[model samples]
Target: VLRDERCTNLSSLIFATIFFGNLAFRAYYSRKM
Candidate 1:
């Protein structure tokens, strides 16, 4: 159960990182344009 929770947390963290990264990249590109 603990291992499962850890995996879930890691997945969520990765998802959030990707989400934010995409947003940042979009903003950067928009600024450049």
Candidate 2:
């Protein structure tokens, strides 16, 4: 349980980063179109 807390937070942060990054990339591509 001790390590799980840290892993969960890190995993969520990574997921959030990727999600936002993809949204941003899509916006950029849309603007170019």
Candidate 3:
């Protein structure tokens, strides 16, 4: 579907996924330590 287009939604989704993942990871590590 996004084969020929610059998909901002896709990038945004990826960024959000990574951002939340990092946030959760940090929280987990901080809680552990």
Q: For this target, which candidate reaches the highest lDDT against the unseen true structure?
A: 1
Tens-place lDDT per residue, model 1, 1-33, is: 999999999999999999999999999999999
Each prediction's whole-model lDDT (CA): 1.00, 0.99, 0.88
Better of 1 and 2 by TM-score: 1
TM values, all candidates: 0.95, 0.85, 0.74
Query: Lowest lDDT 10-mer window, candidate 2?
Result: 2-11
Q: Rank the candidates by lDDT, best first.
A: 1, 2, 3
lDDT of 2 by residue, 1-33 (tens): 979999999999999999999999999999999
Off-target runs (Cα >4 Å) in candidate 3 are 1-6
Pairs of colliding residues, candidate 1: none
lDDT per residue, candidate 3, 1-33, as tens digits?
575345877788899999999999999999999
Error of 2 at 9 (Å): 0.4
- Scored against the true structure, residue 6 in model 3 reaches a CA lDDT of 52
